[model samples]
Target: MTTIARSEVLLCEARFYAFHGVMPQERKVGAEYTVSVTVGYDYAKAAESDEVDDTLNYAELYELVKHEMQQPSKLLEHVALRMGEAIFQKWSQAAYADIRVMKNNPPMGAACAGAGVNLHLVNDKTKKC
Candidate 1:
């Protein structure tokens, strides 16, 4: 008999400075942003194989997020969604992904830590087009 295992890879609180807002100053001056990503996958092989190739490469994941952040967007939702899609497209083993994008000290006339969007995506291999 064999047992199945479920696991997740997380890239948390990655900080970046980029242009990602709907204002002129935001695009010109850029702002501090934080991005977090969670990817669901089965890591049972890597746990035993002890090989980096057996599991999702977190460094690569960071690169994906960094690439998406470089492309300026007017909405955090757009950024988050793109990140999620990139993860799924790159790694077919990914079952699902949760992405969060936050902008620190938003210009919305309020004293707050940050404001942004969270996006969840599922890979439906059985879904027919």
Candidate 2:
């Protein structure tokens, strides 16, 4: 006999600091970054046991994101997309992941004000979708 359960994890607007930009000036001058992450997976079995270890620990997840955010990148999109990959690597059971990284007061050179990027990724372990 096997018991099953599922849980959807949603973390909206998780804030952090990242040095990501195309120009050297931008990288040298860091900016405030906002991260929105969502991870979904099957936690049926973990739920049944009523154990904290059975389900995804948000604390650990946050740590991983924070670490990735510190890594400098050329583009926010790259940061966002890679963040999804990091999450998947940390949690193999995660089926769906969406990431959004926002840079406050971006250096647009008058072309634009603030700019950011978003990315959505899905684990292809089972090809569920």
Candidate 3:
């Protein structure tokens, strides 16, 4: 059991290109990657302006994920989850966050292609406030 309101917060999503996978070949042979991130904030006014300072620049978020992906990792799921935590810890005014990273084509010891991991992450907001 849990309790949470229909809370609304600022959100943003961006795509990144990186090499992340469980297999060695997958890590060595890089491919285009995509990550989606959702941030929670109370930026209702900023959403309307569409200004750089007014709203969260998804470009920056992309860079953050891109950098995180570059670091060696055994599981994309871990990378995705860490990203959410990093964002909240690094960025100010960010109440919560979610991230999903996926490898476009994974080496399954076959000459076929398929979709990769689609993970979800949630960073907790400070309970104090």
Predictions in order: lDDT: 0.89, 0.78, 0.62
TM-score versus the correct structure, for each prediction: 0.92, 0.83, 0.67
Q: Output the better candidate (1/2) by TM-score.
A: 1
In the range 60-98, model 2's lDDT, one tens digit per residue, is 878888988988999887777777888888888788887
lDDT value for candidate 2? Answer: 0.78
Name the regions of candidate 3 deviating beyond 4 angstroms. 1-16, 45-51, 109-114, 118-120, 127-129
Worst 10 residues of 2 by lDDT: 2-11
Winning model by lDDT: 1
Model 3, 35-71: lDDT tens digits are: 6677765555565676767755666776677678778
lDDT of 3: 0.62
lDDT of 2 at 10: 71
**Could you tell me the lDDT of residue 35 within candidate 1?**
93
- Give lDDT: candidate 1, residue 69: 98
lDDT of 3 at 89: 68
C-alpha RMSD of each candidate structure in angstroms: 2.6, 3.3, 5.6
